[model samples]
Target: MVGVKANTAAKFRLYPTADQAERLVSWSHTCRAVWNIALAQRVWAYGSAQRKTLQAGEQCSELTLARKEHVWLRDLPAQCAQQVLRQLDAAYENFWNPEHPARSPQYKRKSHQQGVTFPGQAVQIRKVSRRMAHVRLPKLGWVRFRLSRPIEGTVRNATIKRDGLGWHVAFGVHRPEPVDRHVNAGPAAGVDVGIACSVFVSTENEGRQRPDTLTAGEKQRLRGLERRMARQLTFAKKHNGGKYSKRLRRTIAQIAVLKARQARRRADWNHKLTDDLAKSHGIVAVEDLKVSNMLRSAKGTVAQPGTNVKQKAGLNRSIADQGWFEIRRQLGYKTRRYGGELVAVAPHGTSQTCARCGTRDSENRQGCGRLFACVHCGHTEHADRNAAINILDRALSTAGRAGCAASGRGTAQSTRSPHGQGSLAGSRMREPSSNVTAA
Candidate 1:
């Protein structure tokens, strides 16, 4: 919000020809080769000197080291091999002395590795050929992409990544401003996220409804594929060591494809949901749910008070599928994109805390089916909606923004300001805390 800075991220799936695809695979191989070579050198150093860690200068030099064993670097162009080894060194260093003491860097396998980047220089596009790239690797040809989005500012290299369903190239750019900062300030809203209806709002239209984008049809297809996969099984030979048959392997691959497609669908749903909220609302309020704690708690599992173990497992699986982390990530970026504020309210006591008189002790309303009622002030509301409203109130109050709550009885209390100045914009009523009661 202070320093006006802009950046661009563009991703496009490459429709490479068969030859191009094979070339890309070879490029991947080259990257792996360079990394493995560097790794081998580091291992040898550690073994020879019996040292735990080696410094940058102490490590093998690019020229002298590559000449003796890694001759591939000499004939296959210097930049490619140099960048790969540089990345390998960085990876090894990071793992050896990770920022967190508890986290230890594990070995990286070459089979899964896909890319390498040069800070600001790899795959540079010339002025005349600004939109295309010439991949000058072993057998890779010139790969081109339609300039879907114009690239502004310095091209900070490119990364060719293998995705779940396809291959993609991402271009990171330092771009010019698209919209003014002042154009982004708007009304705030509280969001109650759920599986049934992704997000329920309590601002702007007061109670406007937005349906969950995860289609039922997509879910049915996923279930069907899973069932089909479960029905197919293979047993290894008792004497000779042998895995599943080729036909079975193909079946497993098909299941993997289906699962990946479902994941992509879910990701797209969350992105669109977060984008809409950020574009429309200036301030977004959400609870900082301890999802891990929830999963471990009694409410997270056990349908009917400890009955139906199978049902509880199904419930847990569905909860994990909802993609809570993805939602949070999208919201963070979306808020920044719109120049809006996103407040993650503390989720503790939000559900039981009464919005009317701020009383939080037992006697307000017993947790029955799915509703909340305050005994002291006699305020009643839908359980989830009430929690969301309370979260909204706390978020706005913390930021010095204005808000007020309505009572259950027909009468209204006078509006009070945080600094005793005036009521919030269109606030109906508010009251100071009084007698406390939980149920």
Candidate 2:
């Protein structure tokens, strides 16, 4: 089968020597400074009488001159500093685009995570042993890294980032072969994501909950650490002129470590879940949820204070914990990789509408219960499962209209369909009621 080229990234843990690590940190700071300086220049240019917009090429020319004048900037790799300018330019371009969701570029703070990118020509990788590799970078040669997996294709670029855990390097590679050459021939499923249940599949008639990333003991320790950090912040503000003490900095690092652990665990679980869904189903359907809008704060203006502030806060936390957007993002690429299709449908009244009867009434859902009893047809089923079924039905109808087929390679793949008034009119599927309370 003829294959298409695809771009992917591979990440590994880096083990730098003490001096190299210090230099890496200093270079990150330099990059951050470059970003801030470029942003300030752009702002000044825009506000000036000429209102001239600075381009990356113009900034690079200026950066070359500045490097000649300053020894510190000269020590930093020229490519790395130029990359920062390019990133700032891209940020501004995204902000200017009406369809893009990115906000305007902002000044980088000292606390922000640090990273630097090197073009393909500036980085050279060499395999040292079965489990070790070495990458030669500009100004910093022969940094050893754990080869968790073999690099699959030609390296296009590499980015090094520092987090609470440690320094890591990610290589962007271009593969000659496509992720999936043949279309998938498998079953279809609709997934309904919720706070109580992480995923509910329409075909399975069951809901699955994600395991907690942090254990009970870890949660307690995290809470205690947060409280201690708050106390330290109070002391620093009142007595130390808002300067962080060594102990306070240590506490912050500890907190970052725990948070990173949780994030890694969550990402692992999401990857597993998405992989399974993509491999088993030729067509997977899900609600097109705007997670940012769902997570908006409910603290209204002082003139009209919001009600149930604490309840809203808790709901926001639950929504964020589920990582709804992350799931959608992973499913998007994974489905394509597995020769499957991912469909997103409007989620207007999936919960209230009956999957069997097409009845839409708010009274069908009584309180915050798992059971969904349809008033029109007297059909009762799990709320999430019913919603999932509705989502699948809508996706199928949308695909049918778009001339999609069961083989998964179709025009409807990754398409979003608006909710139709009569879309759920005849979606009648029967399943055993024994698992109505599975969640």
Candidate 3:
């Protein structure tokens, strides 16, 4: 049956007491230990069977590790222990499959994760009359869930994770809704993505720019973390016994936290931007940018040795914080839900080329210019707005152009530049020894 699938997230605001936090951490540790034990048992079974294959099969099923055998193992819940075995089996199966040759099976370790989910076990949800959850874990008696929204479908599994800021529980549910249709308004809209102004919309809200100040702050924090990490690394190198300083370890953990914060901020903005676009516009047009390639080019360009780095670092940070991929992902689903469609147009020359006359020449455009003074048609506009206009025009010219992967082709795609902003002509860049694909 044709159906729609959506993940309805319900985040609960909870202030778990220190005691509750400790209990949760202990449970997490127990889960990790159980998983490692199960993995070890699987390895032993494979060896006893005189087979080099790591895939969990009949041999692994025959080898059962009891809780009483190990004190740490006994601390884990029964369902958690079972899930560990299942995960080991699944991991082994994946490693054995030749089609996925990149991933190989490896020994489980503590740092892998401390969470477990059992598909077979029935997930219990207890809402007490006065208390939040009637029955909690052995130590955490009654945890509260300030559930902002209702959960739909049959929740198949639940996972508790220690996020950077706090603890969170994610529920996986099975939902079957009607298929969402993709509809577009009579008019088309264009978007310009950049570091200065994260997003510049050119339609309902003309000339409106969404700046990423939060992203900038996160990067500033990241720069501080990097300095601390570097100093710690230096200290470790000088230390004997092949030992690392405790401060170094703590710095790494801090860096991880900063990364998580940055990720959260990016995710938040992407959701907001996608929601706005889906609700306001029928068709959304955006430039196709190769951010991964761009970042690779900027790695060795950082000049400074410490917190005081090159200016390009800020640009690099901004690009990452923009969360273009996350925006695309959210838009892909949200557009269908609200009867809208997203289109990616060729980014080449969209910024430099005149949207009014369709004339493209880099020579006429000065170094890193933001004004489009077209010699052929005398068209002038803000650089981003001009690009946006061309994006909208490109969307209108080609049907199904917004979501087509091949939209990266065409005369709008660029060379040398990441965003394809400096194409000399309305022609694809000539590769001396490579074929130019569609934009």
Candidate 4:
């Protein structure tokens, strides 16, 4: 535990017995209660004259006193409760830090609290069979879970959580990195993420690779479920929310199942695509997209009502269905793991700029047209394929600072802007920098 470094989490489904399930539920409740109470203490203290902030170590001592008063709290593990306080302390730190994206820590509700984490000493995993294993917990002993795969290293900690599907356990085991060096034998490629297609890849071996999006049947099914759930909720509310409660639950569950399936398919597609890219490409260039910003709700305020809100909403769904950010994230890690480079260039004029003539005119980009016919040069190609080629060329034009930095070259590096702007003033730096739009 002292030397182990966290590499990744290995999650497995947990099939708890009825008695154990009740205990796990109780533990989740206790953790949530502790978090809310601790948050309240710090918040109230903030308004006081002294304005002293609470600390986890101090709270750990207070927890002992509280357990003496409320015997029920003692039933759960001490480390679990302590971890909750530590989590709160970390949250407060984040709130005070200027660089952190932390907001005010709010009280955790039972439905929202994921679960509790057990420290290294408290988590003991033992293999029961080739495909099954048992983990010992604080209150519930020997809960059986699928083996799924071998735990690579010593289990440092375990997080118990429940999702729409079911309960599961995630082990934070630290596996050491291998010392062998990797040499890239594959070619460089550029990827353009879009709504119509999940991603259009421009690689040397294959002129262009475009993966299919969610099937029409799947989209139709999701829409049907959404409508059915909405109708059931309306009926339940009209009936004072008691008589149609069962029917409402059934409808909600169906929607959850469909959403979960959709998520799984996207994740599978993303992983496979990334794996191939990482394995075959030494340099992967992608447009740095702010997905959440792009997907912001189109419903504007009262004064200026949004235009084409419904159309925008549908487009947002398509953008989300592509999982643009997820693909980028996976490529980042996978490229590093495979000793490759991940270059994220600015996404400003990739579509409008022709790959042939480098034309930046709007006429070069016909609206809703898959074909890109450059009026200046008369170069015609698939719009996505054209964009992908531009992205790759943009990434390769600068000798790629990402690769230089990863290979430990920290110095003045020039970057070419995607908009065909002149080179930015070069400066000596310790880390790699890419052409990203300034906020």
Q: Kindly list the per-residue Cα lDDT of model 2 for residues 205-303, writing each as its tens digit.
A: 679899999999999999999999999999999999999999999999999999989988998999899999989988889998878788888889999
Clashing pairs in 2: none
- What is the lDDT of every predicted structure here? 0.54, 0.81, 0.57, 0.71
Best by lDDT: 2
**Tens digits of lDDT, candidate 3, 57-157:** 33334334556576665665655555555556655655665432225446556555445443312344554433243213333455555454555554444
Ten residues in sequence with the least summed lDDT for candidate 2: 419-428
What does the lDDT come to for candidate 3?
0.57
The CA lDDT at 146 in model 3 is 47
Please give the range of 10 consecutive residues that has the lowest summed lDDT in model 4. 420-429
Q: Candidate 2 deviates by what RMSD?
A: 10.7
**Model 4 steric clash total:** 0
Model 4, TM vs. native: 0.80
TM-score of every prediction relative to native: 0.65, 0.89, 0.65, 0.80
Query: Which portions of model 2 miss their true places by more than 4 Å?
Result: 1-6, 177-180, 410-439
Candidate 4 lDDT tens digits, 186-252? 7778898776655778753233233444478867877987898788777767877535577777766
Off by over 4 Å in 1: 1-7, 26-119, 125-139, 176-180, 204-233, 236-245, 290-316, 361-370, 402-439
